[model samples]
Target: MFLCGSYVPPQYLPWSPGSYLFLLETCLFLLFACTAAGSAGSMPSMNNQLNELRSLAAKAENRRTETGIPRVAMVQGKIPEHMLAAVYDPMINVILQGSKSMTVGDRTLRYDPATYFVMSIDLPAVGSVHPSVSGEPYLAVSLTLDPTVLSTLFADLPKPVGRVEHNLGFSVAPVTTDLMDAWVRMLRLMGDPDAIAALAPVYEREIIFRVLQGPHGWMLREIAAPDTAMARVNMAIQWIRRDFAEPIGVERLAERASMSVSAFHRHFKAVTNLSPLQYQKRVRLLQARTLMVANAKSVMAAAFEVGYESATQFSRDYARVFGLPPAQDAGRILGDTRAIRP
Candidate 1:
């Protein structure tokens, strides 16, 4: 038989010291869990806000316009999750919903709900967006950065207090709550046709300001500064992006960058992680891939189009970079596409 006593208060239970410690620890853990849960819960709202922004842009613009001002576009519907091989001219891309991964050389970067990806210089790369949940699909807003405006803004701002350096044009960084809020506001402006005319530039400027103040600010600063080593390398990169078919002499590239031969070599490699010749080869190879897959250019023609003088040399380099000779890589690309299509 058990003798029942009066209810024991939590503070006066048997093994009270141990019980008290356990309760205290349990409460602490619960508190931490709740805090974490709250933070996690906020993410869905952020994604929603981004989605709303994209929706506004989509509703505002009817036809895709090609102009001197790089366009801001919103895409809808089902898009095949495939790699796009092209040069990313100066642009800021914000993902309002879904997510994407971009491959440049060996590195793969993800841009999703909480982040924005920027390409401050021209670069050839491959990019793909992941599929969405519940068929809601992905949403993205792209605003091309105006280099003239960027250069102007840099001159107006006070000189930063440190030496500038060049860096890869592409970067991924977390967008601030303030920046996200600004994006929402800008998107709202799109609904007001009158306001969009007056406000889009203002919003775009604000976005750029947020970028200049963000983690990769120094990279932007260096790119905008005309006399910096990074600026020199950027000029070389631009030349290569635009004229890959031209045989580039090291001295000639150095002259274009306004740097001495050795200085240009050091700075170009430091910024791009590749020498000028290597950079040209990379761009040319990517172009060759595009020509083969999209335009149905033969291996020899594609090679010549990208400035490869010798067919054997072209095949060797193409194989080295793409893991197959031109003919084989072209066949594989076509085969892979056919396999994926319904």
Candidate 2:
């Protein structure tokens, strides 16, 4: 059976330095050995689990069947030629046979077999999966983010021992063995629809549990604290995401989020590392691209759909942000949207 209790020192131990030293070294070595073995063993299992999920996802995609809400499956032979600008949502992605990477502003994260990434809020991201192995192909799975469950877990937790000055919306870390196993079980359930409705909830909760207890746990923690600057920034992020087409006034946004304009600006920039206008612009550009690709809107139509008044202005701003005017950029991006969201 797995050790389910927290690690605690024995009640009695000899108070001799020699004995203590030996005991410490022994325990340290054992800890190291466990960690090393767990880390190594986890990589292959993650790959295997992802492969299995990808296979199932491919079948579902081919049949145009929806697995459920929060999951978007790409089949084995299908690869998104362009990255996607995914909306504000909670989702986790696994790369089964190939590698994927996401870029958030200047920081870029790559996850292969050893690692995965999580985003707690609605943020703009660009992601892509590399061409897969000839036979294996790229496989991935996605699910929605749940906030109520996260809040429930943080109720009794102590204040952060030390707070980070900034918390990025997205983070990448090595996936643990426990998480890998939980994912494997979740993927396996896809093959048995009779069991999926009941089993999937349990497995999904288990995966979130692993996240709450894992390396990026603190990031998730920061997401729920309403008094914190990061929380305010998240509110502002939500506001912008929901109403991107409207004229965004920072003062109004700050007031809506219950902060003074200055505090709002400071905290918003601190978390997102972007000013209010810049953030909205980023959202607008991404939304415009999504509209063009998914809705088949013309450049002018897409620009208007995302709140741009002037097609020329939209093209100029789009070029500045994406380095190409709307038509050309949309064409190039539509060719492969997978690389756009991570």
Candidate 3:
């Protein structure tokens, strides 16, 4: 769960700085396209496919899989509570046997069996998982987003046409019968390792195709088209995560997103529910937690290494976020690391 890969294409260049005039001009000469997805109730066939997906993923360990499938992974059982606070990559996650709640900034969303959520950009979030009523373990699977793959599907699709959404980069939608069937094909390939190299890509496209037909299809469509607000905000996010330790100015970040400082800030917050600086802070804090608990680093050492100027300030912020002072939290989590490390 903590280990996920991100693949961005070469064509997706990082946005440049110092373009205030253009920023105002683009303040959305192009902005966003919005749609609602997944209103259909689960069908009988959806339940059947969902069951197969669960069985295929049943043996997944507490961590990611070793299924030999590229960019596909599953997890079952309790997550190390701490690892759930993370800077999550772009992916579509479907919870099969249990429910999970994800909190991005002040917003929290929950999903249960047969529900999947799409996050179109990197986000800093905290999450918790629960097992099914029958005591079935928490089970889920994920497909990491790849720009190259999504872009290839663009030619066959309709141009995105809809109302503009400010910064809604992630959304939750119910699983449809067709989508579940596609996942069934994708996961069934695991049983025939020899067939994967040839068929995985084929099934992968079908799965994405089903998702593209959904209401949140705009998310998939717009993200592939780099000029959209979601893609632009994604560019700014990559900048923040890349130089997280360095001091960042909102103006520079806005320039990178090709929006005015005010527009940029507004869009960024709309998408991430946090300001750019706050986003960086979360990345830092999450990294610091990993350093202390996993590497046995001291409070000040973890703080300084993650770019905090003052250990005192780090402690205060850490307590605010994690609900414990640095030293105490580290000590408590240290002993529990192995419980979830697998």
TM-score for each of the candidates: 0.74, 0.75, 0.84
Give the alpha carbon lDDT tens digit for every residue of 215-289 in model 3: 678887777886878788889999989988888999988987889998888888988889888999999999988
What's the ranking of the predictions by lDDT, best on top? Answer: 3, 1, 2
Candidate 1 — which residues are off by over 4 angstroms? 1-48, 57-70, 76-83, 132-136, 331-342
Q: Which wins on TM-score, candidate 2 or candidate 3?
A: 3
- How big is the positional error of residue 39 in model 3, measured in Å on the Cα after superposition? 16
Highest-lDDT candidate: 3
Global lDDT for candidate 3? 0.82
Question: Local distance difference test, per candidate?
Answer: 0.72, 0.69, 0.82
Worst 10 residues of 1 by lDDT: 60-69
- Scanning candidate 3 in windows of ten residues, the lowest lDDT window is 31-40
Clashing pairs in 1: none
Clashing residue pairs in candidate 3 (N, C-alpha, C atoms within 3 angstroms): 36-215, 37-215
